[model samples]
Target: MDSEDLAESVLIHLDVETLIPGTLKHEKCEISTTRKCYSYIKKRTFATFVASKRVSSSPTDTSPVWQCCDETFSDPSSVHKHVSNLHAEEIEQLTTAALDQMLSQSEEAFQKQEDPNESQSDDPASWIPSTSHLSEEELSKGPGEVLLYYSYCQIRDPKLICSWQSELCSRLHLTGKVRVATEGINGTVGGTKTATKLYIKAMLSHPIFKIMQVEDFKTSEGGAECFSELKVGVYKEIVPMGVDPDTISYRLAGTHLEPEQFHKEVQSLLEDASSKNDTILLDCRNFYESKIGQFKNCLAPDIRKFSYFPDYVEKNLDLFRDKKVLMYCTGGIRCERGSAYLRSKNVCKEVYQLKGGIHKYLEQFPEGFYRGKLFVFDDRYAISFNKDIISDCSYCGAPWDQYQLCSTDFCCQLVLSCSSCRQKGLTACCPVCQAKEQRSSSSPSPGRPHREECECTDSRPRIPNDTL
Candidate 1:
């Protein structure tokens, strides 16, 4: 067998089972690097593992490595902030710019695709590797089924979300990430609203979900379809901050102003503020989530992880606290706790948070609450409110709905890619993932796919895949 073939065989046989949950690694962080010189920057406590990938490129125009959003970062270390921050725009910009300069030959779209009318040496064949083409059987299985999540939050369980990918959220046909643990449940599930409703129902009835009021997901009248897969899992904490224990804290509903009161206060605060005093509208959702939508005037932190919200807020504390501080998130839960946490530390002096968070406000002012899309945590991916679709297409730069993402690399992270771009097989997740899959094991490549940032949970402690 060739050297590369030998590696593939070794990888499949080299105890991939070792990466499975409860088998060797308690958490399913299975890794399979597509290339060599894999490096990562992880938090001391393992709360986060920021990694960068280095592709073996040469002066030759001939390389199998389809350099999809892979550039600038000489190694994984420099790419640390890129992944942790979900800097899709920055990555896209840099990669596109670099690819433009090297037009001597386009990257191989995929090795196997063939065009009937075009010459093999002239045009590259491409495939949108995402599961957008859901099979009828898979859709019927649980197209719109909801997967519930909850958390018994505390410092000890501060890192619950990543560790708890053990929650038995319904897999169905959805393909987004989910996590639940002692601290709470958090994730991005995509599918039909009905499937989401079932999941929400289960959570509302769950012992802990009973304490939290998760909104039942709704379908858009004239928007893109929902998630293509129903992925669900559990983690250690609802949100992993990757910070020293001393900096972590969480507070919920009862401790803060009610949704209505908070909303009224914000409206009044805005009216009373001096026009030039600098009223700051802050969006506290993850980067992927925020890319879809935000209040017209809010500072979009566009963070990838929730725990980093505080840090973003602290950085901008001086810019807003002195004036009017209007904060919000997917639901009121985050704002309630986020505002409380900031107030506890005296981070902001004049603060007003969205009552009931954005969800509640959308109930009455769906068309007028602000502008742009609203990030959601269920199968709906996200909803475009008030005729606003601000998120950019990752590939074509068009305004895209929430359901699309590159099927390339860990491009598993949600992103906007136009239909044309997707059809061009430009997904970043799938091509890279497939390349990683085809890579020969002998290269001493990272032992797994780009999983340093995520451990794809194959099954959950409460619900076994075999049972499904």
Candidate 2:
């Protein structure tokens, strides 16, 4: 069948049933499957589409993204130079650019410079109308704290919107990315309170924010500063999962454990429960997030993207269903939707997840049932929730990313590895993971050759693309 016909056939034969008395997990499976197919096709055609329009570009290539494990390089120096010169070049470029922009922007407040009014309009973005907002005593009434969170919404009015972000950001100084769209806004912005308060006010008053329950709309469980930046903008939807006409479901359908309680329960399971079990522990986190830590017997799906998760779970439901299935994600966000979806399909016998995710678990355990750092999409690299170091890399097997990847550039596999491996080379999480060389802004540099094509397998189900 043609791609379109295949897509339809794929969507059929998928039965989504909520195990609860009566409920339906939004046929998110169909929506996600369709998107995955389109993405596959898009990646195949995007280059052609671009090449058709431009003659100056070459077939894209990239530096091999590597994941190191027990791997100790005989050529450490060579690998270091290769990493520093080859893979790290563009990372340096972006950092340098960001630094330059910050530096140049800091050279403001000219005295008797060119034109006086130039200050007014030329730097409208810089202008701040001063006002006596709060007293030093009140602002200093309490010690400052950190706030990490995911916040998204659509932009209704920019005159009110852009300034809203700028004003609060200027005052509180949180850093993140945001998008504005007619459809709606979606982004995870994080920062300090003084700054968060700026955007918080607008959201607190919006209708969309109101629609979500106290848990989702206002998930303030993890202690301050789990997130480092706060950015606000407009986007079509907060999360970029594509839209399809699949009837999807989103409702409570799990043994939701509070953060502290979940922490205790996870520990209890690890100590008392069998690591070798008929039940399956499923980490609903993206590949990168799982690289850091997961339950003892959990099933880590080799997926880098969150949008692809439902599809992965659908494909693997057979392996886990009939068994006691415990699933979880960072902030319980995915489980909130994922568990409900799974039950809709009768995929697992028992479904449960931590209430606030590892973020909350960390607060209670101080150390945790899992180990290592938790990779976040934000700039903090990862938050170290567990004191124990339980994971290592899949490649040479030294350490894991606490974040992992696949081999395809389009699938620039996110995976886990140790610090030494992360320093030595570039590779995605599993061998099944895609190598990202060809399509990334950075091409695979030939500074170093592979000892052999990576033969590692992620503990997860899929095999990584082997072309890196």
Candidate 3:
């Protein structure tokens, strides 16, 4: 349908009881059968509508203008028909983008009305400002710390926990992503050292999070500025393995190996060539993450997202049959569930996961078996410890590991381009994306490529031997 009609159709299905001000509601919509639709809209055309036109508080702007070509619809059926006939491919993304813009506008309005000393509202739909009001002196005193940690336990009130986390992080002047769910909490927040210390103290004191210990936190040198902004919300899954948590729970996870123990195991595997045939070092993270850095001779999967891990394992069952396996990720959360899935298959002789993932391992052994940089989910892109460069530039084949978003406006692919190639404007992930960038320069509005055609979405099994 046209942009205006699409927005109208979306608002009608928003299910206001479930749509909160700060969180994007992710329930499926019944509007379409072919695609999974959300109750909100935030995609390209709808986002433009939200930005240019303000929603009236009264009856409504019945004939609001839309960015797409001039069009008028008399009924909902006509709008449905128009949308199905034209924008079928992007229905899911469109709904997701719509929810984001709506939530953003609500957050902005909340900030304007918020009082620093006022008590927080218990309302589920209430939004809190993510930006902190800490003074410059508090934030400028010392080194910063980025904490990575996750806990899996029953949370009776995730919405309440989500609300408290937003306030806590904002008060400490922290930035990064925090996700809370019925299962537990997973977060990576960065801020001043003092603030981070206070945060850990507060978390340990909390009745629900008391199960966490200081050792659970994995810290690195970074500040709130390492991330673009603060984001705290509740979600379906803490790690998003795309499976029911009840079916594959962390309680069924494999043995947790401390840094020293894991080090000895890796050393033995590296020294004994014959052991390689019976032992497997598997990287549970996605292809992009493992590409920059991993333990020497590890088996890194070629999947793009964690949700695909179960499928990858099911298809490659024979690879792990009767073999002793060791798994790891950026932090340890993925392995908690990943190893559980692997063990559920009952194909391995024994399964083990690095207790704190690569973060803790790097702290104990900065120049150890793992090489290159650690890929992070923030504006900093990655954090490095050693001088080794394992991955190469996507364009010129020069040794490099730094990642930059593709220059193509509509593309989300991350490309590894050396400074020389970047200076020459070689930033696209592949030849297909580079051509799209050239075309976008001449057109005012460029259409986004289908996800199936994007290089970032490719799921083919990549040859692991070459990555090492």
Candidate 4:
């Protein structure tokens, strides 16, 4: 059968829902098979059409004017039905043009597919946009770039949010991790600039994230293949502060201090002798994160993880009983819950947090009070804001801030190692891990070495052996 006849037969076998232009319910539609067919055909046709028009000299001549209407249907049958019923004239025109071109290029197209040496064009229009799933502006942003962003808000159903986010991220070719919880969503995704921007727009458009703005997103530039894969999951809490979301309410948390206000507060506390004694600048990040970079005189807890924050707070509760506690974290989500936890315990006279946290603080005041490198969770690992090097090399006593993973097969701990020490093959975080690596390397088996116990538990790379 001909292309038009085949399209009609497919449409006849499939069910299409007719609805008002703006009243389609995306959640109710299940168009798995039809969507696959639509995507495949759309890509093939658009690619061939763009290739055929690549020789046009005029800018307008090269641009293909698509006549598809604004209203989208995920199912191919639904799209065909919509075109046949509402846009009969346009469908007939497209069908005729597309079929004619397909027939003329049949030989060349088959040859191109078979020839391994033939490279595909890098033009934007060569690949069809998933317009049914994204906006025109989003599609115009193109691909092959990356961005980073996060959000915190109330989420009623974390699992449901996870499912939706997973689907959206997958469709957009995004990677990175997302944590959904009752309190909100905490995510760090890396994708094409277009995909990431659309993800943020779609998120802000959702009812749950209506309060969020574009400025709330913290972005970073990277290649399109920054992250290895995407991971969207549901958790008890986004930041894992070990506090009940119901008990410690973020709405009643500490007062938010902007970058300038926070800087002034820090300066005033340092200059004012009397108030300096009463005020406490607390670092609400993990020991590893704060060890390299922190505000001078800030009381950063020497804990392993955020889960240990509660115990540290309980032990130091007496110290904050009459003091004004000022807390800050990497992004501010942790501080929201951390400050709330402290206030709920009635341990401080007043509570305050740095709005947007260290990330924003550095953006505003690159040469501010904060010193040393700021630890991050991405592949870049750490970033330096100032010349201060607070951390020392794990193997050697020389000052260093660069972090490297333990050289062992299984241990994933991070350690500060100077260039000199790294050159000396002292890569393991601890002696135990070093021994493990040595044993694995000396083993006879060529495949992945057998698992061995190493004392390296967390990201911190303190020496496990007493002598070391």
Candidate 5:
């Protein structure tokens, strides 16, 4: 047999039950003491008996010889029997003693290492993740949360806050997007319950965020997995209203109405059909957002992005003229600046905003005027308050509010697709996008399908003066 094959046979026959004494030698922590001992003995025994028998300096020798306890054996079976009968139990006992000593020493070393750290004062800077010891599976199964919040207060250095947020999020093992601007900070982070709680506590302790209370954060079920990655950066605008913050300040935003007050106003509008003629319930979010969950009898714009809201308002100036507008967004951040922009036009009679937006409204009244799932920016896409669905699949006529990013390579449009269509692989947002994707697949190129913007992603006029 070949030398490699002989080595394998010897390893199979070697007695691995007995461990080497820890006092004999040091090995890597990853290598168990018992396994290390067995390895050492197997190497020595195999080299001396097996290798010497088959591969020898003097080509005349072919008999196996195993030496142990001042005696020798010519046959492999005899040597194995002798070791099993005479040495196995004694070796096992010795190894057990060595393991006990090693464990005790390890414990003592660990205590000595921890003593100095324990004596020091507890600081958040030195905080360690509590789930560091948990397995990936355990972390996934554990209770977690996603915090959606925004603060509109002036900051001297937004870059400093941005850097701090990046480091803080990394340390806490959080995953989500955080936009820090000179005006304020807006973020939606997801992590373990402990981590999210710690994040809220840290924010509260910061002087810049003193105006924010626990109520400012709208929390929902889900964890770090809800977000693909952690992105903390500085931006010119917190909510991207596409207007110069210097020109349209949130300080000039419309009057804020509490959830109850806003509910009453909405109920009054819904009860009286003629009241809606003079008063407008404007949804400040994008078409996709309001399409899934919106207040009854509200006007949801067909704008694709938040940046398009200003243009929409500019184009439809007559719609808001002499009308009382009630604006609301996902978490109230958009309405802060959106209302300011609308009021700036001086066309609207009065502009009021939902203090905490749909988030707070649902918290106080889950079965209130708002129906269906609340659209979110995270991987969750949407969180439901009631089973009511107000949107239909873009592909089919079936009612479905769940939004999935268009599968077209470069298209960013979110398509409302029912489970049946999705299962059939109808992921493209529109017919043009689906045709483009198909053409790219059958092309001569061999990489990911080349993609370009389609009509589905382009700007569109506002929806008809009707609530769908």
Candidate 6:
């Protein structure tokens, strides 16, 4: 048959949608639906007719006597027209080029599916080495890593987000706590580098996080068991600031400054004689967080929990008025609402916040002006940014930064106690609690004592010779 007749016969029998590149499988074909009897060719062989390529008689194309055939066309109609006019002798070469392109695409897709590891090679044909064969010594050598990230965008269904996050973390073998709420998502997780990278990729894969980049994540290195297990749940608020979401919006929060810029601005404000009195560096975190470490000369509120921040702000409104307020929190989530609240009141001349909070700052400047350890919510309790000891033992008044729960069996309050004092049985949060505990232990029980009902129960007890 002539090429034109052969092309027509082929086109009449094939599914047009499947023949076209980048077309959806369910897309309706413009051709008649009744015809479907073409002799099926491999996808690689069919790819040749879809695109044009020049063929040389020699591998190097050094000879001048070679003929070049260009059959490439973009639209399906144009490709059909080119195929119809082409001779059957050219079919073999076209099929070969199309198969090469198909193989390239398949390999590209497979490479994209593989995990990103330093040991991975750029050659698509190279086999991916499995970590399964690595020795236990090699696996246990590196320090574990953790990636802490948060988003302040509105979440329509927090429960759904929580469920997806839980499954994703579990599948990746990650251990951390993630809280999803109407306000947004807050998470602090730790795992092997591969698992953390996969977790980040999975998180950004969600439609809600498409705008966020991987650099937006804050990462820290820790031991393998930094977190005990994965816990994902829906909550009223991501940070529990206690303010109504309607009253504040993160979009209206204070100016966000990067670590270097924040440090410069802070130094400049401190040096300016006039602005020094008019500017206030505010710590938006709880008193316990600031007690372990804080920015130099910052006005950290003396509140136990973030919920009491509103009351603290209301009482100290006079200090904020006509001042340029610089605020920050651990991971910047608290500052998102805290700065917005300050702006809503119209009390400060200007409000600026640390972009990623202390965590980001420490990553950039490990020995910056911030002194002592940064209190964290995990079992690590705190991580040191610098060697500066800014806190003292509550019992003995010696320099100490580690936080330990009160030695009293019933109280859960955390207190700083030097190793010597903790070893000496000074575990109570205060002297009053210590004296009360002694009296209770000395007194004889009238009847069987209920551990839960006992007034002198210590929720956290310090084990001797070990840090709690």
Q: How well does each candidate superpose onto the true structure, as a TM-score? A: 0.48, 0.50, 0.68, 0.65, 0.68, 0.64
Tell me the alpha-carbon RMSD of every candidate.
26.5, 23.3, 21.7, 23.6, 30.7, 21.2
- Stretches of candidate 5 off by over 4 Å are 1-141, 442-453, 462-468
Error of 5 at 100 (Å): 78
Candidate 1 local Cα displacement, residue 411, angstroms: 4.1
Determine which window of 10 residues in candidate 3 has minimal summed lDDT.
30-39
Candidate 5 lDDT for residue 340: 85
How many clashes would you count in candidate 5? 0
Worst 10 residues of 6 by lDDT: 31-40
Model 6 ranges off by over 4 Å: 1-142, 439-468
Between 1 and 2, whose TM-score is larger?
Answer: 2
The sequence of per-residue lDDT tens digits that candidate 4 reaches over residues 136-222 is 555434554444445556555666678778877776777888888876788888766877766777777665665577877776665
The alpha-carbon lDDT assigned to residue 461 of candidate 5 equals 51
Quote the RMSD, in angstroms, for model 6.
21.2
Model 2: weakest 10-residue lDDT segment is 15-24
Alpha-carbon lDDT, every model: 0.45, 0.47, 0.74, 0.66, 0.75, 0.66
How many residue pairs collide in each prediction? 59, 84, 7, 0, 0, 8
- Tell me the deviation in Å of residue 466 in model 6: 37
lDDT of 3 by residue, 328-364 (tens): 8888999988998998887786789998999989989
Residue 192 in candidate 2 has what lDDT? Answer: 41
lDDT of 4 at 127: 26
lDDT of 1 at 243: 37
Per-residue lDDT of candidate 2, residues 1-468 (tens digit): 343442233222211112111121242322112222222222223222222222222434232222222233333354443433333333223333333343344345223234322222323233332325865443323333334334322334534444555564545444555554433443455544443444455454444343333333322323225445545654443444332213332332456667766665555666765633655667877665675667665677777566676676566666764666666777665675567567666545556777666666666665556666665565355666456665666667664445544443344444555566656654564434334333445555456553322334335445232110
Candidate 1 C-alpha lDDT tens digits along 227-283:
454444444445454433234444312223455665565566456656435555666
Cα distance off (Å), candidate 6, residue 281? 0.4
